[model samples]
Target: MSKIESIDAKAVKTYARTEQTVSDVRSYRLARVIEQLKISNCPAILLYDPVNIRYATDTSNMQIWTVRNPSRYVMVFADGTVISWELHSCEHVWDGVDLDLELRSAVSWIFFSAGHEVESRCATWGAEIVNVMRDRVPGESRLAVDRLDPMGTSYLASKGITLLDGQAMMEMARLIKSPEEIVLMNESLRAAEKGIERMRREMRSGITEQELWANLHYENIKHGGEWIETRLLASGDRTNPWMHECSSRVLQKGDLLAFDTDMIGPNGYCSDISRTWTVDETKPTDEQRRLYSTAFEQVHFNMDLLRPGMSFSEYSEKSWKIPDLYLKNRYSCIAHGIGMVDEYPSISHQVDWTTAGYDGVFRSGMTLCVESYIGAEGGTQGVKLEQQVVLTDDGCVPLTSTEFEMDWL
Candidate 1:
């Protein structure tokens, strides 16, 4: 059974309260989406993404998440009441909510053709629910589905349902972090810290990147991070050039390792961090030491510069010298916005670094990950240091408490 399935109904309710409850975070999201819907005059919004569904109803019913087997759908009315389909597949979706928030009978299973498979039932159910929702709402209520597979799209079109792009609006809604989200993210950070520490203790000269990946990945899940992004470990000279693209290369003496991993927290909130470490006990080369120091300084410099109202591009200018002077890397840029993904609103190039719009201004309540990469003398070997931070009115708050010096191992 899955971690969610193992959760007793009572335990699930208490677990939600232990951190940020999904209802709190998602209620705000729903409010914003509903406001937009009113502006667009879109009567009902169909959410299909797991993240979206979690944001809307705090439920983890996978039967309704995939493009193939959607189990449930959520409908938010202009009056603020939300109706959602209840599915048996969801072990106990309502285990956490206040008892007062009763399930609406009208939102229950909408009948479709019999003898249908799981995926077919999901698609058919989605269409029928939307049709029922349309009939209940005023005349010509524009139906907006968050995300739909091609087959689902064709099915909707057959019924004359209009499709819309809600990515920007949804992303904008989730950009800010709530106190509860911050708590869960912090929990994830702790798990990441523990996993990295484990890697440090077990690492050896012959350890391969793939092996290290498995070590950190498994440890994270064992430590309460239910979902983890791919582990990236590039060692030796491989670290300098194609810094990304996880490889199966083995570790070697004097190899500099660079990596970044994300730990999934409660309710899908995430925490990501990166570090550079060296293998073997030999004294580091002067060049290697200098490059590592530069990367560390860059991460600190960017973190210190964060604050509300500061344009992201303006901050990039402050660290332009590090790349040019230390790494001989002239491509200086602003840091990216990070939340659901590592790259959101990717950094601005030096050419446009001074521009205002591209490098969005920093604001309180936003989370960002600052990473610095440096290649060996001829762009042959590279090193990177990254950390998660939450913007505060004064500056920024570091999510992971790890140090830059990877030698702590």
Candidate 2:
């Protein structure tokens, strides 16, 4: 039996909380933002992306809601000063206290006024931005912006302020994690493992795929998780082509269930883990065993090839080659960097380097997720496995601890 299956549900929960501890996560994350500003040669950054704002300012109010409406934003100067703007009434969510940064309510007049609302709001918001820039940034200083609406863009154009790609800069900064960040990531991984344990206990024939997926969501939220990234959970024939999300399909006596937990846990760090299991009272069929073992071998082989100072090109060239039959339906990337969820520096297959790959040297402190999927285009089912690891001075260390389903192997 796998280590996860061997443990009882209560033991799994205890293990998840064993190493939980507090750290100065805010300071560490701010330091990273400062480092990014220096590297990118920007005087300040205007962050519209909620994730980047959360990283720079260490504050969040209705994060998921902000993704669509974007009712919040943050401005961080290279001098370490931060200003956050949120919806006026939503300030109560933070209990009337900002966490380690200046907080202000956004201009909500557009909501109350109807005539020329967009133009008026944009102009007013532009004036506020100009005022902040005058105070925090010098004359003719270049500003980086992650994203902006059309109105905001037009206003900035009128102001003649240059905008750089602040999203790329933030991704570069997040590529390597700090000690405190690692602590939060470890905590997140533990929470994810607990969720996986719950799924293992609940997996069986006659359960709907959505029901199984709900088990993970319930466990994660109960353990202080923020949100799950995707719904890529499938069983039976849905597992063959891959990328199939959870549905109402009921699992049968002998079916392969595959899922990827793109979980954003405590402190906003992401834990990207994938596991495949068999929903059977007896052992898996020979075809099922072969597929599972191939995927397992692929994951470990690529993980073993990881080391500090390896070039992305070199790794891509030397990585495992999926069989011809399985290559057609292979996942987009063999491995990808993960911090806030698939950050940067994706290592694609060697054949795909010229088209879809990036060039960089893997450095110590970089965290990555090795991915594997083995299935034929017309096959009945497939197996997928992924593991999270961080590069150390000598070798890579695992971040996720959930074991592979042994019964399938």
Candidate 3:
């Protein structure tokens, strides 16, 4: 047996074979997609987003580049039929991962490829999609689509297809985690910790912010982690405004460095973690200490506040209320769902409820990140802290293992 096939389902089921061929994560995720399709009354989903495709079929090709290209795609029917298309050379790429999926050469009708023939080529792509939907899924004209170009959209619409929100269904399905997935996620989290540890060891007065940030990427890739979503590492003054991408500026001994490791780690699970640290052997300023303490308070307070049965609105209402000094520069949401990427239910703050709030219940098996960014309106420095956790009947079990700078306080 191959390593993926030999993996113990009780141990690392993520790489193990699916139920159709053997048993484990590939089957579990596909079942989640099917369950979601049925709940949404969607006959099938046409997946163009590489992340969605990866979630559905356990396969990939040029993941980042194809995000905007739409050249690679898949169709997953509610009845459990899966058909995928990729570059001709990649026809056998998925091989043993999903035994039931049919693979073919994907159509490329983007302007870059088709030029003057974009329309006609798009029509051909649309017709093939419709034919497959009719033949495989049979009666449903309603197709859930993650994304499509205008030509493809108009063409599919003219042919009596109603495109439901596939991304919503996928997000809903992804919010809850299976036991097996947690294992893979923890493995990815370990990769991130290795990366963070590298950063901590190399952190010093003379190191540039870019040099520090590169350590995270190097550790992630060296350990089989795929990518980091953001370049959010800053020291000293750059920390004050927040969201500053890492730069080449040399650091000073007492500077406060902050970063968010939006890493898409192994098995495509994300480790969206953040922390602020002091550069080298220097005493933190009183202002710096205050910021770290406040941010930590917010993160832990909200992390403890959440429960399995609480509604999203109630959670927000009773959640950590940001004080006046730090209100303006709050993190976008108290928390958000995490899976292959930042997935669903971005719980806004109470002040943001008027426009951004939505209602839902926090449920068991859902993984979340509690967030905090503390900086006064015109402050000179700030602290960003976040914790990744999974909810169960007991309470939040932390996925993040990085120790906070508690000694600084």
lDDT of each: 0.63, 0.80, 0.85
Candidate number with the higher lDDT (1 or 2): 2
What is the C-alpha lDDT profile of model 1 across 1-409, one tens digit per residue?
3332233323322333453354555666667666767777677676756666666565655432343455455665555666666555453676765322335322222234234364565465656665666666746636777766575667676677776665554566566666556656666666677778887776678877777777777766776555665556788777765345567787887887778776564446666777877786456677778777777767777778677787766665664455444344422344666665553555664555556336566667777887777674566567777778777665666666777775532
Clashes of each: 5, 0, 0
TM per prediction = 0.77, 0.90, 0.94
Which sequence of candidate numbers ranks them by TM-score, best first? 3, 2, 1
TM-score of candidate 1 to 2 decimals: 0.77
Q: After superposition, how far is residue 333 of candidate 3 from its true place, in Å?
A: 0.7
- Which lDDT tens digits does candidate 2 get at residues 34-80? 88898888888989888887777656777787787666788888888
lDDT of 3: 0.85
Candidate 1 segments exceeding 4 Å error: 1-23, 26-41, 61-73, 83-88, 98-126, 154-160, 243-245, 312-333, 340-344, 351-359, 376-378, 406-409
Location of the lowest summed lDDT over 10 successive residues in candidate 1: 105-114
**What is the clash tally of candidate 2?**
0
lDDT of 1 at 143: 71
Candidate 3: stretches off by over 4 Å:
1-23
Off by over 4 Å in 2: 1-23, 92-100, 108-116, 406-409
TM-score of 2: 0.90
lDDT of 1 at 244: 58
